[model samples]
Target chain A: MSTRWYPIYQRGNPQLRVFLPNFWMKLVRPTEEQPPNVVTFAVSTEMTKHDVKNYLEKIYKVPVVEVRTRIALGDTKRDQTYGYITKNDDVKIAYVTMPKTEAFKFPDLFEKKAEQLEKDEKSMDDSKEGFRKFLERNKKRPGTPGWFSI
Target chain B: MSSTLMKCLSLANTLRTATLRSLLTSQQKPTLAPWGAVVPALASHVQAVSGIHTSAASLGLMEFFDDPKVWSENEVKVGRAWKPDELRIKSNKELHQLWYILLKERNMLLTMEHECNDKMEVFPNPERIDKVKISMENLETVVRERNKAYHLLETGETGERPQRLVHNCFGLRYMYKSCEHVLPPFMNIKWIKSRNVGFGGRAVRKFLLQYREKLYNEKRKAKNRSRNEVMMILRRNPDFDLEVLRRQFPQVNIDKLRNEDKARGHYVPKIGV
Candidate 1:
């Protein structure tokens, strides 16, 4: 059953099964300190606490013990020049709790960016120095080709 | 001491042989279960047995890519997106299964794309995501078509959202989709009163008049500007194609425009010999 429509539950009817769920959940870093077993997620607005629980358990294979969700009000500000007000869309934040034994920490993806940049700059400098030396060696004989070198 | 050492060596040898035998027997057995028996066996054993192997091999999350080993490879080749004709032949159950697989693939692609952007690296074969998106859209369209047909057969309505033309407070027309409401229109006194405050007040009429005038003036000026431009072009180039100008500006009357004094070129025409 799609989340858009739900049939009324009868006593003897079978439980509903969602064949194609359209909900999406993105793991995000928490703005505040959180428990080691708790993870934050930005999920589809249509998703409920139960949906978040099932999504983590079934799709992500995470053992979700409990789920809590809240709608975060987006910021609103008046335009500096026009004086018209604008607001961003509200986002649904889901806090999924895994088993006590499980622990998760957001990995630092950009940790080595500075190091990589330093290495790149080093190589660039080396190439520039090599080209300068080559030019110095051929200063006297302008027409002489690079192949003439030892 | 010598007797004790000899006894320990014999025990170790026996243990070693037992371990070797068990290892050989385990190796002789199937490396893995055929995937059919791993899940609950269906009532129809023959159908389940045949379907399991085929579905296990071809369908589901397992077939999204070549394998884990191919992840580190520089390049991997795959066929084009699934054509509509090929998907049309599949059963509803199979199509449903394929939808989940595609959804998972799209998620995986999005994750990779996000990581690539974060790393400031060019995402390889970005078109692969587009192909998957197109395939999913086509699949959804096919499903929706079938759903609409089935609904029409069962129910009198088209099983789509009920919508009708509605006017807003500003008197602008828009389609309003009717949805389920907890209270009737009569009971909803606030809504009824708000809706009763219909548009087209004296103030609104004045505003609308100026707004319409503004639109009309812009259009009128644009048309006049284009007409003047056409005349200037004709005056500059007497040999200019009338058919091209006529096609270019459909609003201007080319025949009447050609006879105007402004349309005549600066140089005098030579008299007939």
Candidate 2:
């Protein structure tokens, strides 16, 4: 069943069926190269392997062959001044194997963003240069109004 | 073709309404029916309810959006959020039906918001999401209240998580909520080991003493600083409202301080008979 709260089960408890499962699974790019059917997801830490499998199969209607999950320890860094170490919360990474018939490739969201970034940088530089020129022009005529210039 | 779309739209609306009602009314227990078996029945019910509004060129669930006439309009008028009293008056079945309708409405709003964010355009009526969230929260609160009352009546304990104030290893006080476990406390070696590791050490005692001293020092300095500030203010502005100063700095004894030399102004005082 889903991660929703339910009554405790007795010895011969019937299978619990979750009506509305609220778990969200985001498809993420795998760091290392893997088989075509093997996909990775950064799921909620509380999610179990079965939950991930059911989530993909039921919600997204994707055929899941097998599911593996691991809680990866987050990076810990020591502060330069304080010397105290800070650690990020561990994340549950799910490696799901889909049916061979279906294949998924993580699409690059930032592919078109590179050109936009270049244009933004160019505009920023132009503005900075313009401001510098304005400052130079007013340097010789301190307190003199800009309207007084030719 | 148009009629089919309208039918689907209506079905979704009905389901959404039903879900919302179920979420709101805690008194009504959900009939434990296998979802796979009841899917067809639920679908048919949705279709039956949607058939009522089929005359208007059968639009899909998305058809619940603002009319094409108002698409370009800057603003759209809408009613306020559904009050708890109004929802409470509705029958359980009606509420259940309404819940599904609201859920669909919420999903539609989220879809629209996502599309707007992607296009870098302003989403019309952003408050719609807030209204839906508020309604959902209120419904959950109502359900929780009913659940708590039921549990209190049936059992001595509340059906919520049990919590208690506890001092951690750092000697800091915090609320620790107890939860269910497969193993008993004695059997749970990991939990027992962790609990054993928590608190009681010479280093911890030293740290707690320093921490408390630091806190006390801050409080004492603050009080002394305020007292000095009041004295200075009285010395400069002798005619200042003593009542207001005393009220503002409760820690400072303004009445006794008022008779001090520092509180007396530089101006000559007239002798009293």
Candidate 3:
């Protein structure tokens, strides 16, 4: 059966199961600090606390103690130029509590960003230096082709 | 460590071994064609490089994020989506596994996109989502095709949702996809009542009449236009191929129009007895 076509669950009928679930869950950093055991997730709107628990336990094999969920209202702001209001989509957030021993601190993703920028700057400087050296070399022979001499 | 932790460690070890074994087996196999060597080379490179893989972990929190290398990169390159023909060759089990992989990739991309948007940063290579979507769609289509073939073999009719041409309240015809219901159509009073729509009334008749007249006018005008074009062509070029004219303007009678004075060109035709 297609994913969209769901059969009505009667009292005696065999339980319906989803084979290929297309639901997506993203682990996002929480705005407010919480216990290390508690991890936040932005989940599909259709997902429930049970679904979140099953998803992590079965798919990712992460041990979950409890699951708390809330629907966060999307931000709304007025347009600066035009007097119109713009709103973002509502997101369902799931707070999954792992075992007491299991501690998960949101790792700083962009910690090495400064290092990468420095490396990029170094490469840019090298290129600029090489170009300047080429200009210096061609000063004597003004019209000489770049590939003409060593 | 807990028993679950031990199980996870073992699972991770087994997974690593399985991946390595596959890589080795693939590389050892002889290439059928000269171009076939590229797959093994690329596969091995992708499999071996752990540093380049940003979030490769065993049931860890890193599973939700993208590769660190791609996070700062301006562009992320990806191959095209899986074609139906390519997917058709894959076994059901393989397709199922591939589907999950694609699903995870799509989720990762979406999460990254959201984070980027939230940070007011440009999302790199947004087309990656579209690629994954197309792959998932193609995968579903392949599965559906297989299901249809099997259903046709077992059952006489296709195991698909039944639909029929139905008219709406506006008197416009459309295909209505029918679904399974707990009660039969006759027993469902609410459904029956809903189905009974504005199929009558003087307004509908008048609207249909005007609509039909408008349609008829358009058709009539097109016929006249083609007829006039044929007449004009015959009048200008008398020696024009009647066969070609007949093929083009089949609605216009060439023989009848040929005898008309209007069809004759300004230059007199040379008559040989």
Best by TM-score: 3
Which ranges of candidate 1 are over 4 A from the true structure? A1-20, A76-87, A111-150, B1-142, B149-157, B182-197, B269-273
- Report clash pairs, candidate 1: none
Q: Quote each prediction's TM-score.
A: 0.60, 0.51, 0.70
Which has the better TM-score: candidate 2, or candidate 3? 3
Cα lDDT tens digits for candidate 3, B2-42: 55445544544443344322532353321111112222223
Candidate closest to the true structure, highest lDDT:
3
Tell me which of candidates 1 and 2 scores higher on DockQ. Answer: 1
Q: For residues A1-150, could you state the per-residue lDDT of candidate 3 as single tens digits?
A: 454466778799998887677888888878899998999999999999999998888766789999999999999999999979999888899999999999998765556656766877898899999989889999988988879987
**Regarding lDDT, does 1 or 3 come out ahead?**
3
On a 0 to 100 scale, what is the lDDT of residue B185 in model 2? 97
- lDDT tens per residue, model 2, B1-273: 566656655644554456434533556333211111223334442121111111122233222243443343333333345567656665545555455545444544554554456556556677867776676555555555656777889997677877798888898998886766778999999988877656788999999999999999999999889988998999898789988997899889998888888778787876893
State candidate 2's DockQ.
0.05
Q: What's model 3's overall lDDT?
A: 0.73
State the lDDT of candidate 1 residue by residue for B22-101, as single tens digits.
42235332111112222222222211121111213222223222233323222223224556765676568667766665
True contacts kept of 3: 0.28
CAPRI classification of candidate 3: acceptable
- By DockQ, the candidates rank as 3, 1, 2
